[model samples]
Target: METQRNTQSETKKSPQTQPHQENLKGTFAAVIIVGLIILLSWFGIFGLFLERA
Candidate 1:
């Protein structure tokens, strides 16, 4: 009975972290997308100028 109560308490602590982990994933993806857009624009502008030159 004592061990069972302890196990239940540990499981309850774990779910509190699930929402924070999901927010981190969302933020990470947003940063990646913005970085890709910046990189693509940099290359695109330079590519056209180089071809014309």
Candidate 2:
């Protein structure tokens, strides 16, 4: 039981020992693209409403 606990603790600590180096360039670009799409769709709907009114 003690050895099992030690191995479990080691595994838990192993992940934390590594520095977080995540590449988020694609994520940032995707977010920007989604935001722009939402904004453009909103403006387009507003334009249609104004034209019909």
Candidate 3:
């Protein structure tokens, strides 16, 4: 029972790494979104294509 309590306490403390991980995740997501927008625009302005078609 004592070992079980210690294990639980250690697990709870590991959450300190989560904020740094979340920031990295946000940065990665932003990069991907911007890249996709640039690619789509370069393919030829999508709205103008639709208007002319």
Candidate 4:
């Protein structure tokens, strides 16, 4: 009976951990998108400068 009660509380802990994982996933995706935009803009500007030269 005691073991069953302990297992129930352990199962409840999973919900608390899940939100942090979701937030980290969202943050990682945002960083990747922003980095790509900056890189693309840098390349575009460089291309225009090269064309003029």
Error of 3 at 6 (Å): 42
Number of the candidate with higher lDDT, 1 or 3: 1
What's the best-to-worst order under lDDT? 2, 4, 1, 3
Candidate 2 residue-wise lDDT, 1-53, digit = tens: 99999998888784446678999999999999999999999999999999999
lDDT pick, better of 1 and 2: 2
Top candidate, metric lDDT: 2
| Candidates ranked, most accurate by TM-score first | 2, 4, 1, 3
Model 2, runs deviating above 4 Å: 1-18
Question: What lDDT tens digits, residue by residue, belong to model 3 across residues 1-53?
Answer: 99999998888884445444334788889999999999988776877888899
lDDT of 2 at 44: 100
Every model's TM-score: 0.55, 0.64, 0.41, 0.57
RMSD of each: 6.8, 4.2, 6.9, 7.3
* Candidate 1, 1-53: lDDT as tens digits: 99999998888784444444344788889999999999999999999999999
TM-score of predicted model 3?
0.41
List clashing residue pairs in candidate 2.
Answer: none
Lowest-lDDT window of 10 residues in candidate 2? 11-20
Model 2: lDDT to the true structure? 0.94
Model 3 residue 16 CA deviation in Å: 19
Candidate number of the best TM-score:
2
